[model samples]
Target: MALKRSSSMKTQLVNGIQLQEFEQEEEINTSSSNNTPSEPAEAKAHTEPKYYTVEEAVETIGFGRFHVLLFVIMGSANIVEAMEIMLLAVVSPEIRCEWRLEDWQVALVSTMVFLGFMVFGVLCGYVADKYGRWKVVFGGFIWASYFSLLTSFSPSYGWFIFLRCMVGCGVAATSQGFILKTEFIPAKHRAFLLPLASIFWMLGSMLIIVLGMTVVPSMGWRWMIRFSIIPSIILIGLFLFIPESARFQVSAGNIKGAMSTLDWIARMNGVPLPEGELREPEVTERGNAFTLISPAYRRTSFLLWYTWFVASFIYYGSVLSSSELLEKNLLCVTDADAEHQIKHNHEEALCYCIPFNMADYQTLLISCLGEVALIPLNIALLNVFGRKASMAILLVLCAIFFMLVNICTTMFGFTVLLFLLRSVVSMNFNVVYIYTAEVYPTSVRSIGMGFCTSFSRVGGMIAPFIAQVLMSRSVIWAMSPFAAACVICAIGVVFMPIETRGRALLQHG
Candidate 1:
């Protein structure tokens, strides 16, 4: 009986142990079944990268040392360009004297440069948009520098026109820097920084004025042309230091290169990269001159183009006209006998060879200072009134000032009017520049600028006809059209559909 009871106990214990083992196996299987479906998803959630846009990345990086460095490097291009354009004003008379040319012929030298600028403007912008801004920019530096150096040794009037026209072609490439800068800069900082860029332009303008005062009188215009190459050479050597536009890189679908640039900007700015990969647009709009005038951008394009035309017409008109106005005021004495002598030998009496005296440089320098001084005003106007209103207001003011120039009787009064016109016109230029850059998408920004600027060159081409040619006949004739154009531009600006006051730059149309 005891043996049977012990056997029964052993059987029960084995049954319990078997039961526990089966339950444990069932639990394990259940857990595996539940987790198996979710494993890939969890892993993906943990390991997948975040995506960022160009503006987002730039916003995270913030404005810092990188931007400051960019401004100096890119702004140097502005200085060189300004000097080149201003050189035309300074040396036109010198070339006229050397070539024994008439006022109209002297005007052609200025006209030819704009012709080159206009002809190549769209092509360079297209190349920049399609290929890259950096290539067009630095390549242009080399091209412009080569042609400019050759221009110094120009043997005759024909060669001089051809070389300088090529120089304009090269100079046309330099405007890409502004587009490059617009791409990189955060929207919040554009108003202050962009208008501030005019400082470099003002510096170049004044620098050439100083050089014109010191160099041209002694060393001649050829030496002045030679001196202009120095900036290009320096920028070319520093080209490696300046990175290509990362915004441009992304738009071009160069994800790897764009990432590399962002890394550099992040490292240079001393910031961490925002989590995630840089996002590229699925379909990039390869921009051309046709894209610029497409139905979507057609209205804005036409208005902007016309604005650029008149703004340039009036700006260069004001610049070129200032020389004529100042020459008349300074050289033509107020004394009746002296005035009579001037009128009698007006062609011979005007100092074409050395038109600007020391006083003229001082006055010109002061007027240029107005561009820098009113920068704060431009910023405020841009921020407060927005682009369209500021442009219209400034344009109207510019016209009034242009008309006012006709009434000035004294040199001081004339200088003051010149200062007002320059300052207001410069403000208009800054507004239009910022407005155009903001309105266009990344794909078409450079091309759009090139197109609009080409029209500006058209105005530039015609400006000499008025400023140099018409001013020779009558100041009233010269000044009236400038005022009228300003009025026309103000009306057109008011009708502009887009006011890019605080807008993000679009990546594609």
Candidate 2:
């Protein structure tokens, strides 16, 4: 059975996530007192009391209508987040034309967004833990969406970068969303469903492609940013519909709230609450996120952080430089239409445009199709192979495919390899989220996630610059480092001791 909070009230007060350990006592005791006191106080003192675990109950209730509804509402953030992350690519060409920006400057604008992740990740994680997950998530959505809208109005490169950085800070609530999803999901389906978040992410990227091919050619980059903000704005209004994690509420010591939350879930699933103690008495202790790296969990902590960093570097670096990679393939093939257009009106040809164009948009769209296909593949991998082994296998394969970019001189071969690499890398990254959510206890789950993500942002920050420099020389130079990183990470994942395949979320330290 998994443990949740119902520890002493003081510990709840000191807990960083503000779990409200004693908040539901009056209501719960009123109902709890009605039931006969089953165990004698003396006997209870001598042995471990029977405690109901929320994990088992959630598993029994299973996912239903409410979960699906929440999936759409809460998970919408991933789409919005993806849109912001890739939005720079959609607009960079227009921005470059207007500002007379060089390749380095355009890359800098894209890189600035992730830089915010590095600066705010740890802080945001702590806030989520100390306050509540939903608060951090709501705040992040507001910050990201508002800045994205503001960024559209930027009068200069400085303003654009600053607002873009703010967008990253706002989306730092990412860890909170992942943790919340983990809490609500059943163990058997956890790994499989978590990757669905990436599907929304891919959708966001595809939406941008549609806009770029249609909207950007006519209205402008500013309108593209504004268009992306519409979802975020609408989601903010729909925020009230999503529920707080009941597991979190119980872990915070709000037994009645937890029960009520569970009852709500049970009702949503059209089932009665399962018979079990939902929480157990715990001798609570307060600690910081550093506790994760303490003697007991240090190995798990470091390994997760290292893998997170490597995954972030490979994924972000690939995405940030994908256009240039596609451009390499584009230049290799002869396009009569592009040539004819360039011969007539150079600026009007999306394919002949200097850095990015309609050809790159088509490539991005095709790559997204491959990513979308992998949602089912990822679900199967997590179920059949489990988290760690699946990640290791995919990482090694992704590394091979990414490096093979060097040998694929023809457009078909190059594009095929790029699509495969993107798909596998997407799977690898989603596995990290599932693994991270299961690795840590609820007490510091968000913080642990945030810390690992911070490491990712560190990679996120530097990967683009590295990609930019190597890409200036050749795509081979950029891809070689990413492929090597993938190999190193693949080797590292083989050493991970935990395999979160249908296992209970590790609760106590």
Candidate 3:
């Protein structure tokens, strides 16, 4: 009876196990049937759509409205700075006559101004980093404007030189404005628009020439210098509308400030705010000024400094010498009093020694027409060829033209070539501003650019002296060295890497 009962229990256990296995198999089949079609459908749904945050959308819109507005304001400031720079070149003759200055003495004014720039440019850069870019820019405008206004009151050559040095100190602040622009402008537009920002420079150059021809001779050079103050006032007034750079704020670890500024930019741009982590702290430490010389940046530092020195040497040398060159070249055809008259009223002078009269509408028309034609070319080449290539080509072309100027005898030939060379060289000047802004890391970029620019001012300071001495012998011959310098610059440019181009300011290694 016990054996029969045990057998019955085992049979019941086996039946229960078989029933559980059958239920599990049925559920697995049902799950597989449901998943087979839905897998592809679910993936397809994921592929069909995506979303972006407000910040991503805003950044996609490129530069915000505020950024563009600030660029315009800063660009105007640069124009004013450029006008002051061109003023001495355009009116050197009048200033020399008024002050009874020797060639070296006349050159001292430019040199002193540049000396101030060299000393203060570095200082301003450090200040910008420590305090703020806007502060530096505003200070520069105030400083330069005050000095430029005071320049009109100078009683002697020494007094003027002292005042001009102050002006240089003020103008050194222009680099801060430039850095702010680069920091705010979007990457896609940088390569093209960065150079375009220099349109104000060209405008300033043209303004000085136009004003010199129209106003300076009539009102005297003092009034001409005074006229430069107006632009600074306009720039300062416009500054109220511009904001500090978001990137700069982020780099300084003011994340909250950065976000606030970015939100403002977005609202101005009519776009939503983005969602992302703010920029992290710079891996490299800051505070020590000498860190610019670290191993990673040493080569860049040397190359940029040398390049700035050489480029400034050539650029300022040519510009400072313009008035002296024009004076000497005109002297070949007329006497002192007659040349002065010709400068004052070229329309009335017939068969005068100078090839073209500053006052003559035809000459002005021709010069401006040449510039207009070159603008499109500059705009096209700068973007297509990139900064390095365009700069290299322009330098070589300028060198060749400078050499050709020595050989060309026909007035028409000289006029055409000279005008073209001026146009081309002016275009290259824009390249330096863009390149300087692009090459350095954000932390030291302003200082690097400012230092080089200040050194370039040194070149500017020496230019008049060199030109005066060279012109004291032969005007054409003095320019030959400029051609050689250009050749050297072309070679030096070879070491520069292809620029950031349209890319944003890059991080240092």
lDDT of 1 by residue, 185-281 (tens): 8889998899988889898899888888888889988988888789889988876678888888888889899899989999999998889888877
lDDT of 2 by residue, 1-509 (tens): 12445455546668834445465666687777865475466567667545567777788889898789778876787888888877866676677678876667767876777778877888887776666688888888888888888998999988988999988888887547878777888887776678887778898889987888888878888888889889898888887777777766666677787788888888988997776567744314322686788786788889889899988888877776676554433223433334323321123343324545676788788887667677888999899988899889888988888777666355565567668878998889988888988878777787888888889987887787666546755667777888888888888888877777878875566
Kindly report which residue pairs in candidate 2 clash with one another: 5-251, 16-129, 16-130, 17-129, 19-252, 21-252, 21-253, 52-277, 52-278
Model 2: per-residue Cα lDDT at residue 269: 84
Q: Sort by TM-score, best first: what order?
A: 1, 2, 3
Task: List runs of model 1 lying over 4 Å from the truth.
Answer: 1-43, 282-285, 330-354
Instruction: Tell me the lDDT of model 2 at 12.
Output: 64
Question: Against the correct fold, how does model 2 do in TM-score?
Answer: 0.84
- For lDDT, the strongest prediction is 1
Q: Go through the candidates in order and give each one's C-alpha lDDT.
A: 0.84, 0.76, 0.69
Clashes of each: 1, 9, 4
Query: Lowest summed lDDT over 10 consecutive residues: which window, candidate 1?
Result: 336-345
Would you give me the overall lDDT of model 2? Answer: 0.76
Between candidates 1 and 2, the lDDT winner: 1
TM-score (all chains, Cα) for each model: 0.90, 0.84, 0.80
Model 3's alpha-carbon lDDT is: 0.69
Model 1 / residue 327 / CA error / Å: 2.1
